[model samples]
Target: MKISAVRGVKDILPEEVWKWQFIESASRRIMENFGFSEIRIPVFEYTELFARSIGQGTDIVEKEMYTFQDSKGESLSLRPEGTAGVVRACIDHHRLQPDSVSKLYYTGPMFRHERPQKGRYRQFYQIGAEVFGTDNPWVDAEILSMLHLLFEQLGISGTVLQINSLGCTECRPVYRKALQKFLRNEQASLCTDCRRRTAGNPLRVLDCKRPDCKEATQSAPSVLASLCRDCMAHFEMVKGTLDLMGVPYEVNERLVRGLDYYTRTTFEILTDQLGSQNAVAAGGRYDGLVEQLGGRPTPAIGFALGMERLAALLPEETNHSRAKPLYLAPLGDAAMERMPLLLHQLRARGIPVDTDYLGKSLKSQMRQADRIGAAYVGILGEDELNDGVILLRNMETKAQTKVPLEGFVDQIAETLAGEGA
Candidate 1:
């Protein structure tokens, strides 16, 4: 019998993991600069947490979630998205105090049982950020700028920003009624799932990917047309800020994001490079989410991007400068005994160094070192050990030098510090 990986999952091999490291590191640095702190939530949570926060009618709750019952008969689910979990954490921890704003970021795997494609996976990684306790549009603009800066820093080009206004509680009900009436007229032309959405979350019908549903929704009432006075003012402010910052965007009225918690100032960063799944990152405001999760009425905005998609868009050879080891190859049993001490000395000075424990011949050790791409190879033989000296061979140029072991660590440190390695 043979065992293979689950159908929609993939392993990140060593060759591909550096791209992940680069993306994650870049995300952390950018978030830190924007005054957002890191927040980590559990991989699984009570099933009710999602149903209430993401809305029972949304596709994520109705179809994609990985939910099950624990031994105690309590239902649990692997998180399908980041916002619901973040809202739960904020409410549970009381981070939404009356007057202060809280900015937080999270990175982890999200599970969804969906058909996999080139840039889509059943289990994927997401880097998300959420800000609580402010209704100001500047905060929304700042989040957008931060996401823009991240893509720019990564050298990821050809991305366009699509912005929209879903309106707040004051206007959404009016639009929902109008949208339902329009969908009712086109019911026969809609897909089965969209017909259900018309009854549950009519707004989600606009986001459906089915060709028939897309056609049916093309003439549906736009949420923008129904924006109340307060919502219109807020939307104008967000747009004005983006213009001042010179961030290019388009007002896309049909872009109702997949999740149900969002409200006002929604946006997505898209690139044509990735074929059907072109959205690299997306997010928007959710002013009512905190209150719905049992906290006080707190206004929040945030976004999340798939790490895998971001990595795939990155140039294949972008992160080739990561620091590696200075290999130490001891040629004889006598020199091998002193290898540990030498390695310790180099390590103490903060030098990344490595040596093989297997009793391989000198030629084999050198070959292994070369394969690992070591910066330099230090050859220690019986004579060199007795004479208190070691030989250094530059891997790139194949140049050699001999130095006394008494001050070897300091000498190597100075050389590396001076960029002579």
Candidate 2:
């Protein structure tokens, strides 16, 4: 039987995982700097959580989510996104206590059941951060500023930040009617999904990526045009703050993101490197979600970076560029006996070290080290055994040192530290 991984799923093999680790490390550093703590939630949650927070009209709930019945007949779903679970966690644990704010970030795999394409996958990875308990426009600006810093640190360039105002409860209905009217006139040109969204979520039609749909709605009414005074002021302040911080952006009036929870301020980080899936990150204010989900009214904004999309734009220098392990190759039987002990002690002290398990010859072992780009190689053989020493060779410089076995690990640690290994 030729069994294989399911369609639209991918395995992040060892050779390719350095990029993922590097991204995760960068995310942690940036998130912590912004006073955001890490938060992890279950991969699956009650189906209604997303259905409520994401709104029943959106595509995520209507089609993409992985929903199923548990053994006890409870309806559950693999989370299609990160925010719903994070907010639910806050409410459940009372993290959003009275007069308290929570800033959290999370990175993990998200499941969806949609068609996979370039820079788009059914099972994709995302790193997202959320700030709860503040409705200030500066909060939105701060998040955008942090996002800019993240991209700068990551070496991603030429990405565009597009901003918009989705209005609020008071003014959105008016825009909805305007958009619904326009969509009706252009109904024959919309794609099937946009046609369906017209009746359920007319605003989502603005987010449609179909060429015909975009052309049809080229002159469609703008959400910014319908922004109420409050939303207009909020959007202006957000842009003003971004300008003050020297963060660059464009007012993309047509940028209605794919989610239903956004309001007031919405923005997306986009790039032309990826063909159709141009948005690498997108987020906005969701002022009513917490209260709607049974918590006190709170305001929040966040953005999630798409790993696959970002990977497409990242330089090759980052892939498999992690500092390599110290490869220990035993030359003879005595060296073999001592191999396990030295390996264990080195690993115990948090050094990455590996040894030959196949009993390969010195030449073959060195080849393996070269294959893995080991920073150094440690050799234990007859001469070293008699003298209570081991030979360490710098793989890159081809420099060898005979160090006493009494403090072999310490000596190697010092050498590696010196080399920034």
Candidate 3:
């Protein structure tokens, strides 16, 4: 029996991976320019790490996480999101002790067991940035601005920023009670999942997508309306900073992100290009996550964008642009025997070069080179070997030139550099 890939997992084949590389590279460049350093954490961690940091009441901890016990009886789970792990790393490594602000960016796969759709996958890749050690709304605005600049650099169109404040610790309790009371009056109209959330995390019920549940919660009290004085001030400052940065955004009062840890300053970058799964990136402030993860009381904010969704936004041709290869086609058995040395020489010079090892005919090798989109083909035949020279052919214009063997590498390097290859 032929085995197929498990459902909801995707294979990003070589033909399509350039898009992912482009997105990742662009994201990293942008983050670096914004003074964010890269941080890498393990794919799996103690299950309770997420349970505590993400809050047990949320769907990620309660339902979607890929949790299991190892043979040693230690319960572990593949991270379902990036923020919890980043926060865990920050606290564990004492990244906040000396600095007033710590900025970090990470890219990796996160696992979940949800029913996958257009942009959602069981094992998906995310590129995220987080800022710890400060609660200033200016930091929040910077995060948003960074996100905007990244998408703009990627040439993604039709993105809209949806912003909201979930209220801080001071006023969320008041909103929670009011939200619960409002949910109770329309209990019958809510979906089963939303009804369950009403008891555990009532704010999450507002984020439910079920049609009946959405309509039922339309009249539910907004957290924005109940923000305490401090939260109100912070929200205004975030807005003012965003305006100063010229970042356009819309106030989405009901945009309580699905995560339970989020408190205040929730935002999502939405695009209609991807059907029902339109949110390309989303995150918010989590003032209590560090404490929950066994650290001192700390405040943090960040955002995570799925690589798959971002790749979908990329143009097909841009994603398919082949990497330039220097094809080394040696004609005759003697030339083939010396091929390895030639390849090594090119590689030592930091050239991306490739050659067929299957002993194909020169014509077949050239055809293969064209198929792989090699930028230049090096022809080393018996005649060229006797003359201590190599024929370098420009694949684009079919132009050929003979260079002495000793100067061949330098000539190739000069041509590629001049062409911006």
Among these predictions, the greatest TM-score belongs to 1
| 214-328: candidate 3 lDDT, tens digit per residue | 8898788878889999999999999999999999999988787877788889999998988899999999999888888878888899999989999999866564464598999
lDDT of 1 by residue, 30-125 (tens): 999999999999989999999998888777888999999999999999999898898898888877899899899999999999999989999999
Query: How big is the RMSD of model 1?
Result: 2.0
What is the model-wide C-alpha lDDT for candidate 1?
A: 0.89
My TM-score estimates for the predictions, one after another, are: 0.94, 0.91, 0.92
Q: Rate the local accuracy (lDDT) of all candidates.
A: 0.89, 0.89, 0.89
Mark the regions of model 3 whose C-alpha exceeds 4 Å error after superposition. 210-212, 319-323, 386-388, 414-420
Model 2 residue 394 distance off true place after TM-score fit, in angstroms: 3.9
Ordered list by TM-score, greatest first: 1, 3, 2
User: Would you list the clashing residue pairs of candidate 1?
Assistant: none
